[model samples]
Target: MLVNKNRSSAGFALPTVIVASVVAMMLLLVAASASTAIREGLYAQHYRRLAREAAESGVVLASKCLELNNDLAQWSNSAKLRPNTDCKGAVVAGRTQYIQQDGNVRTTFEVGEPERREGSIQRITAVGRTELIRTTDGAVWKSYEYRLAGQAGLSTLLDSVSFGYATGGGFAMSGAFFTVIDEFGRPRSAGFNGFGQLGVGSTTDTLTLKQFNIPANKRAVRTYTNFLSHGRNMFALTENGEVWGAGLNNHGQIGNPGQSVAWVTNPVQFALPSTDNVATFVAPLGIVTFVVTSQGNVYAAGLNEKGVAGINSTAATIKTPTRVPFPEKIRADAHSWALDSQTAYAIGESGAVYGWGNNEFGQLAQGDINERRAPVRLGDFGKPGKTKAVQLAFDGDTVYIRDSAGAVYSAGKTNYGQAGVPTFRLRAGVSNRCLAAVGASLRTENCSSTAANQKWHLDRTNNALQVESNPGASQNRCVEATGHNGEETRMRWCAWWSGGKRFDFRYPTNSWSYVYLSNSTDIGGRGLCIIEANSATGDTKMDSCEYYTHKVYAPYNPTLEQVASSGVVDITTDQYFATMVYANGEVKTFGLNNGALGNGVYVDTSNFDTYKRQAYNPTPVKFILPPGVKAVSSWTTSNGVDSKNGNTFVVTSDGRVFGAGSNVTGQLGIGHIGGGTNGIYPTPQQMLVLGAQGNLASYVRSGYGTTVVYANNRKVFTVGNNSNGQLGDDTTTTNPTPRANKNTNPQRHVKFY
Candidate 1:
């Protein structure tokens, strides 16, 4: 019995030990599973953070690309993306991927169509996806996707058309549309689409503007239009300084070689002298075209009848653009061309105006009827002691020239009084009306030529003119009218007169001989003049003058102020503030100030920097060329004082550039800020670009706080504020120092293609 009991105990102990070992193994398995789960959770959190960062970086990169290549047409093309090894190119349409630190992290980005809304707002969408390592299973990976939508900086170019003398019968209308460069540097158009001048790839017209179909990476800077009789031709300049043309190719006015006389519906790039950049272009009416280069040279193409092309040749039709030999370098700042039916005129940099082609009606202002094949110096106004012709305008058979003094002089046919010195006097060969002081009614009677009532004299006053009766008599009194009513004339003491004693005169028509006399103190506030009630010898009375039709020639002396206030001055006189007279008898400035006086600032002489110590000038001072600046190439200024932050930029001969006024955003291109100031360059400073040959700059343009310039080597450089990536440097990150909000200097722009 004892042996059997001992065997049972041994068996029981063996079974209990096996059960404990099984429980221990179960506990070990549970601990291992918990540790693996914790490790995976940590890995996922880290990768998620990295993926988010990668996505944000991709967004910035994509935005840079869009800013450079504003054309949405080819945005989906991989070649247009311009991706490098760092970005790994686009994986799909409008998408680009990047691998960071070898294979550790991968990020991809996709861009969506841009939506332009009213009021200059453009919305853009971007999506970014990142792939991250998650588990040892290698096949299983973690993916993080991010989306961003933001406002894009865009600029819109609006269509504009200007007619020359539309109301005066010199009407010339252009069915041409303009190409505008948006803020992103893309070309957009609106307006007359006849002959595909709008550049929308079709001849269909559009009242609403649309974008152009062109290379996705190209940016246009300037556009030109030539209104022909049947169709209008257009020209565009790219940011790379390349020239392109579209529309009517008839007569080779489009500048394209070997092109048929067919209309071009889209822009076609053309080549000129590859080394020279086009500075200015003009397409006057007819089949002629002119182009000015940065090198101070002028070129012409197309019809050459009467040698209107200025090529010094009588070729009936010139097929391509050829250089026109000028006597002197053409001023890039003020150089321009004006065309009439049979003649052409050009202005040189030295303030010399030249004329070519027909001079039948003295349209060339050369004093005689002589046509020339080459440019001839205009002798009428370009002489010493006279104002230079800064700008010119044509009115059919007449040519109107505006001098630096803002005075307008016309030459050509005068059959309808279209050209001549303005004259204001009584109508000749008509019975004169005589007025005398007789009660409240100013009665007018047929005059005896020698009577005192008919022989009146004018006297000048502080702000008006006084008509004196019987100046030869001892008691000469002031002659006054009652006003618009047919009231009798009365004599008053000149010193004690109340209101009607003073009179003002103005011209009511384009005719130089028409004049209207308005009473200053008249109760009815109407012009007073003699009106015939019946026959030529019948009773006459002072009555309301029909301003639009009534006119009289009175040899009344006047002052400069009177002429300006007469409201009869031409448009040029009304626009310019100061006139600049050149030594060569050429008036280079037409007293008009567009806020771009180019004399450093916009303020009058009284507000000049040295005004407190020097005499104040009532007119704008002449814009003295800098020491080395022989001539002005091009100039631009901020809109006006209303802009608040105004600035000026001037490109000069010899490829030098200068800036004045506000430099808050480094728009001056001087590369540094003023001491203790926000970089406001009140005076002119030479602009400099680092790493450029001779530090020379060729072309320049400016906005609120941004400045763009082209180097002599064909490279583009930018300076100033870049908060909106306007600098085109592939980054929105701004300079940390200086103003803390701007670059405070210039940087080279990245290549878009």
Candidate 2:
């Protein structure tokens, strides 16, 4: 603590001088650290760029390698990596291969192998590493590692170009026939010309597109047609807001005064009065046409038998376009109508989806199959009018939705796993409680949405009840009976393929709806039904199917798939495809995958591609998310059952999206379509659509062999099957990849009421 003020300057220094020297030393050390940090920062940038280059190189090599191997088919080891030319390496630690380059800019690349390698496309990653060096002597210091993901293999993407812009806002297709208005306002068409449906002044089919006989110089803005085999009417909206039609005139489908003629034979302007000239969209399908005017009014023509036209008319057909009683503007398109099934979905201006026509399978999500004479708004899974839908598509009895959140929901005909969730909940008629899982045992408990224990999904695949998910007892477990009378029912392991507890869910008339175990007997063979115990005990037991003391309350449809005491058993032919893409990138897929679920599980043909329907909850699709990156959004789609195949798509944290599954029609939009594993992409192939002012699509909507993409809500693109000109490229040939359809599509005036 003592300081000397005077000391020999050469031998000893003053306290202040010594302290100042120490401080200077400390400052020098800090400066050295800062310099080191700045150097590392620069090096980090260089390494990242190097890593990205490495990834690019890997992709380039793989592209050549896959080509050499004929897309893995020609590879001697098709299931694993086989070095080809400059692509040298092996399947090291699950990854396909490792590529090393010699230099100070050290680089290594690895191809990421999925659980299965069925597709021609594959994913690869690269690493760039560097060593720290001492600035004084240039001696090696420490090593640092960096991983940077860069995309490549876009040669095909660059080849795809836009079909060219046309003022014609939209197009429509049906039964190998397409109705489109070219940029020159000519109504061109090709494909099936039955009943003069081609409107080319003749009834001969033409692979080459031909123009309609509309002589008027009206710039067409919208075109409408149908996929229905029954009525192939085509309608077009003019820039002047006038409507015109050519094709089937039966049922007044062409706005004719009467159904005296079977076909229009030419493009004739409709005499229907429309002071509502702000018509922006025209939807013609089945046997009806709906014109959406900017004034928030919908006008309808043609068949009115099911009130699909929404005119509420007793007259089976309307000769002229009549004002429909729709409360808002009709938000419709080519896929909006499926009138052949007496079912049609109409999007209201309020962003609400309305359904009419056949409700036979509750495809309307109305909770009942009662025929809807007029359009009825559909309810969300839990409540009514909560979700705002953007678009909708149908595959048989099942319906697919493109809602506001970029997610898909399903409904109707769930017996084959079409319904994404438990169609209904069962309550005990003997008590106020509901049937629930009490520690893997069946019991009566207070019903609440806070837990999934009370929610039961009927497994039509095996005729058992299963608990869907967590926050409750027996999660992912199924109900089973010992085939003994008065035995307590318990929740146990479920076999997705088979061996699920075979309990027959029965709905008996003039009696209670019960779960019957036919194997149960009392010293003699006699069926037993699951019944409720005392309200205080919250226990469930098996009793005679004729037990009069208990009842089962199904809040929704009771005509579910089950073994009736003596009636019909319903198993929907529709494929149940439900997937949830949570904000955190977690996905839950329920029901069936058309061909393969991409979870290393495919169709078990012996079981007819069927898993124990509803016996299992939503299963997770496999992929390891990289650290610091998670899934932000995803798109999964399927058309048929597990036998037909489907697709799964996901967007990653790196702003990239990938597709896996059937590319039979090039639905994956990766530029090619084929057979077997070549078309069935069991692993994900990155989607980087380019060309025609291309950019990565922000949203994707895949249809039967066709995919439509919207980029930042400004541009529209399509790929896959161009059969019938569905790709809107003015060509009927298959489009191997995505191309721009960026026409003058009007900004949707979606009213979010």
Candidate 3:
């Protein structure tokens, strides 16, 4: 039994010991897991903070690079972002966009993730295009620099043209729909095929006819070719919605650039913030251009047959494109027309097309003939594409336009192609069919046969050619000279009214001229007026007398006004004069001498007058004095003497003082004297009081007639003119030099009653 019990106890001990060992092992594992978790959490938090800091550093680096290379042309098209570019180890890595691949350029964006474990580590990787074009074109520069923050917008009509004239040269265009001038004197136009002006590839001058390679959409324009420009350059547009121009000035129009000659010649892409250039407006057709020019600015240039040239007359010329006044950044939706270099017809962004400029042909649309150099509203054409443009073309001699959606019209010189109808002459000698056809062909050839001297007339009675007039033809059929007393020949355009019965060429009877026309008719209209060449009538006399007068008076105005009583001679003049009165009782003047209460100086004098003129007028009384007078002051006496010598005092300019005249009782401040000779001193005497503290041993009151003297400490002295105790020493004694006052309870010093 004892042996079995001991065995049982040993088995129990073994099991118990094993169980305790297992529990202790389990507790150790749990503690290790918890500690590991806490350490890992801390490591992760630190890594995240560093990662964020690295990212912020990258952003700052990018911004700095942008600023550093802001003025560089390459920056305009360069799309490289280098975060690792930071040398301070702030940014672990950086990502860039738009890198070069092979021979091509493209755009790409990248990102960098920070790996912070062994200090600060980061990985930079980019997944985007790797090519880009680098050139600083006007459009690109404008977009890049003008971009506020990160975006930029363009507004208003665009034009293209060029010009040459006297005075400072310049080009014109529109920005934000406002007419503006560029650096070049030439008007802005797409005549120069370079610099992507017409959005075309080649840069050449095609005067006769040529096609433009502008893409159907506007956004693609800039993408096709990029250019770089630096300094004094310019660009402009026409009134025909066509942008043209040339200028790269660093001053005035184009702002301050660093270099010179940044001329641009082509219709660059421009669009406002909310609109897409590719979506709204119609793309320019082949070889067609729209042009706009103006003295008041606001010009467009491009193709538009619907009277978009803004040329209201036929005699005017659009030398170049320019800006027009419109709401800033607002797209102009209305139509316009130019009558001449001076006048224009504009349909406001909301109003009708008004005519202005040289209104010699009644082009002002006011039913009268008068030269105007501004815009005037024509009949309303608010309905969509429909416009009240009577005729919108230039006939070397006149302007032609049909009513809105009506027949063709004409205005100005009707000698050649002025009248778009046939003309007739005497066919008596030739009855052959061939001759008749030739004659008819010539008349209908848009020419007046200047060599033949024959009238271009249509058959009003038979709707066919007439050999001769029937004795009494309406004089209205005849082209007559009008305006300026027959100085201007009126162009008559034939109209087939009354079912082709009466054929009368209609021409503007008044004067105005045309500067630009749309891209529809030749001479009259056909393509946009890229650059409207000036007419032979270009007169530097474009200025009027009233204009000169207005300018002259613009800066003239009065700067001062004088307030004067009934008869006061209060002179009003610039305050640049100085006046001097002399002891000789004369006034001397220097400078402008506006006006003062002094004697007048002689106006005229000999050349030998060297600072020498009449000293003064009313001679002053002289008070002789010894060479060394200390102080001076005037005094009065109780004798009631109103003598001039009694009221005088002098302090020499050399620090000496002297006194003279009246001495009622030492009032002259000299020693006391007898009443008669004492009070009538003509000679000035010196007062010596150097020993008195705060030594005011003596003083005189010339204006009010009184004298006083005060000692250093608290002593007081008085004399002179004591009619009412004028001398404040408690006593009414009118003494002179240094009198002592011991009357008042030693309280008050002195008083001038």
Candidate 4:
């Protein structure tokens, strides 16, 4: 029984052993499967992360390419897709593959067409995909879609011109010219090119626009010209803040120690102080030249008569630059400076006017004709009730001061209607008839025995005018000019209740006898004017003021509403606030602080009684920027103020460029630099680049004294100020140096690095 029991037990043991072995094998197989699954999952995650990283790298590369060249068309070209090279060609269109680490990592990216939206905003869609990797059951790829938006850079294709102006006898007759940019950023000139001010390398004047030689990588960012004399000197501030002077250096205005009485044909660089950057350069219509460093220190050179150089009386000729001694550290906000032949003016951030040099005509506004050797306080600005003086304009012996109220005042030489007071009346030269409001139409009729209808009153309280029937009595109706359907002029009722019943009176010429009456509602005087009807009645009506020969009589009043009509007048038409025109065609006329017009800022005037004002706009109208424009800056006049009549250069969001306004000095960058053809463009003009294959303008700046533009490849082109090689053309021909055989076309191009 024991043996049989043992056998049975052994058999049972064997079966149990076999069952245990099978269970062990099943557990091992399950563990192996689980381990393999975990491994596969980890691999998939790693490959996915790598693919995402690769897509991100592709996006970064594309962003860099766009930064270097913002042109979408160029970015879409396959030739430009090389990762090793600078985006010289256009951007890649379709997907382009990039492989790394022996095919372990790969990415493909594609850029979609750019969409230009309003407000100079541009959007681009880019898709990037990583190489496919094996998964548990199939293959998978990672991708990232990105929407990139930015303000477009400047464009490469556009009509553009660079213009400049030199000081002349008066504001009406400044020496101005222009130069046009070709498809590749080359420049040509037209207009006044005397004394090689145009930097074209020759003094021969051309009646038509012509091309000028320019150096590579040298372009003007700011321009300056002399103000008070015919010895108009030209200066250019390059994109790098290097200054060059040409023409009229008889007084060593070119900053060279021995360069006197010579006309510099090419631009010569100025030996500026060791400062890193120059904030601004002021070469007023005088023999002296001033420079303001970023540190706010002022430097001067040229003739030191009356201590105009701001150095000392001992130096008669400032052969080199010297610092100016101010009573206190100059305020950082003091960015503007104006000079006449005899006086210099500067305004501090505190709104204090500083005067030096000659004060013979009270140009300093110090209430006396005492000359100042150094900067001295001239006006009671920043006071409790006073408006700050924002800008200054000089005409012959007179000084025109523009305040925060948008009103201009004269401190010197009030003759020739500089005081804003009308010296003449609108008496008919033919029938001895006077301008009278007959019903709703203006007509030439017999003057009232008491000069009632003949007498007109300027209501300066609100910048309006009234035609009174009595000397001292108020009339409900004012004189107004109106036209219907763009037809001939007709007289209309300008009731006091009418919201836009204001008129702007201006003297187009030096003569005070004749004036121009434009409706305040009409900016730029487009088809709005007060003119004499051609009929036998000689009736005055509101017609197209486009006739440059039309003239009217000044309104007479018993009490002086304001100063006489003289110098420059900027009226607050349309809106009582300020307006700003940006490069992106965005215009904001309201929400401006005092002196915030023309890229300048004034001290806050919330506590002052003086009204806040902006730079005077003859026509208070909004300006539309060219398509794709993102930025704009106006040309600085000789007075260191941006003139509405001067040029405005614009840079497109995609790096294109255009210009508008006065092209007298080829500052507009258009190809009209010579030929006495002074173009006053009312709208933006496209700027072409010479030799620009596909290069686009990345930046633009205007100093009415000079003009400059820059391209994507870092190449620069300048058209003004070659006297001191400020344009970096490597030649110097000073003005008034006899026949130096220098280029006088203001539109001449100079290449700058």
Best candidate, TM-score: 2
Question: What C-alpha lDDT do the candidate models reach, one value each?
Answer: 0.47, 0.53, 0.28, 0.48
Candidate 3, poorest ten consecutive residues by summed lDDT: 552-561
In terms of lDDT, the poorest run of 10 residues in model 2 is 160-169
Best by lDDT: 2
Give the candidate order by descending lDDT. Answer: 2, 4, 1, 3
Candidate 2 per-residue lDDT over residues 457-537, each given as its tens digit: 666566666766534443667776654443557777776433326664443433312323322223234455667767788
Better of 2 and 4 by TM-score: 2
The C-alpha stretches of model 4 lying farther than 4 A from their native spots are: 1-107, 110-162, 166-175, 178-192, 199-221, 226-231, 238-242, 271-280, 304-317, 329-335, 357-361, 369-373, 382-389, 396-410, 416-753
Cα RMSD (angstroms) for every candidate in the order listed: 18.1, 26.3, 38.7, 20.8
lDDT of 4 at 728: 31
TM-score of 2: 0.52
Cα shift from native, residue 690, model 4 (Å): 24
Model 3 clash tally, residue pairs: 168
Q: Residue 402 error for model 2, in Å?
A: 7.7
Each prediction's total of clashing residue pairs, residues at least 3 apart in sequence or on different chains, is 29, 8, 168, 124
Better of 1 and 3 by TM-score: 1
Give a tens-digit lDDT track for model 1, residues 194-299. 5554557877755444665446677666566532122365666666665666655566666666666556667765546666655454444435666777777877
lDDT of the structure predicted as candidate 4: 0.48
| TM-score of model number 3 | 0.22
